[model samples]
Target: MFTSRGPTLRELAVQALSSVERGYDLLAPKFDLTPFRTPDRILDETAEALRPLGPFRDGLDVCCGTGAGGRVLRALCRERAVGVDFSAGMLHEARRAHPGAVLVRADARALPFRPVFDLAVSFGAFGHFLPRERPGLFAQVHSALLPGGVFAFPVGAPPHFGTLPYWAMLGFDTVMRVRNRVWRPGFVMYYRTFPLVEVLAELRRTGFDVELTPLEGLGRRPDGTPRCAVVVARRRA
Candidate 1:
């Protein structure tokens, strides 16, 4: 699912063997060419979904790789937009792509910001965090926002059992687990780790009033459920 401009298999192998930060540093220049980057359609659909709930003044993008989420923030927020990521290389790319955005290098679990943001969004970065790390990650996002602020992210509906996509994801996660077990610096990306029910519970426990809205533009499943939904978590005012 990578383009001609994407990293080579050898390059990807080198990345997989390194730490997450180092891997992203190596992959940063070509990240957007890969399928791993958040697609424009998803970003547009997310902005559309968030439009009604906002008139948001300031926006923050948690784990904003190459500023895709920052672009969304710029669209939704009337005032300033900032992006925070742990990878310096990724932040360099983000700054190049989005010169107007204020980009900071910091870990998601210990975000270095006050409760000043009116809205926060993240894109395609959750897989890097383990299930146990999610609560702290959510708490960091919550603390980075104003009391009435919202944290938003898109989550895909799980694929049907035995389907190609399901098997692909399963195989990917399995390979990652095996790699982590064998390797020194484990790259912690697992596709199947973030279940919706568990995620909603964590958000609630972290003091967010959670809700989900179907992204209609992404289409539906055979059973008529949304293929993807945006999870909107609002900190209690």
Candidate 2:
């Protein structure tokens, strides 16, 4: 579901065929118009959820595409807010949008930062990472944060089996797998790779004390479980 301002089907197909970095470069100019951009509502809700635990100092936004999460950091952190990503094109848009924020070009798997930030947040970018890559990613985040600093992100509950959303995610992952098999410099986005349990375990193993808070504004499922939750992982003090 994209607006008229978003990329065309042909553009999307071209992006899907390109490497992840180049694809995002081509799409960066129109990314906000696409559904792939993190929604404002989610950003607002996350800011609210993080407010109580914060009064934070310096902040970092990992995989900060167009600086949506950097905006969140600006609200919650008292000092500087930095946004990091590998895509120079995405960082270009981010710099224009968040002129006050610092934008850095770096891969998440090997983040180039010290343990200086008091808070770190990411939005809608985890799908790019494979499950096996998560531990290294978490370790990088942990290493980037100050002692007792927080690394937070929201994750949605799994859709009901056999439901349209479920099937849609399954189909999307299948298509991606097929595409990667057939294509070079594959774009690595997948919907089903980041399971909450596995993620929590990885965070713990990476030395974070993990916790979950339901994003009440996002509402609950029929089973009374939250439809979405914010994962707050803190580095040991």
TM-score of each: 0.98, 0.98
Which segments of candidate 2 are over 4 A away from where they belong?
A: none
Q: Superposing every Cα of model 1 onto the true structure, what RMSD results?
A: 0.8
The segments of candidate 1 whose C-alpha lies over 4 angstroms from its true place after superposition are: none
User: lDDT tens digits, residues 45-154, model 1?
Assistant: 99999999999999999999899887688889999898899999999998888776798899999998999998999998999999999999999999999998999999
Clashes of each: 0, 0
Residue pairs whose backbone atoms clash in candidate 1: none
Clashing pairs in 2: none
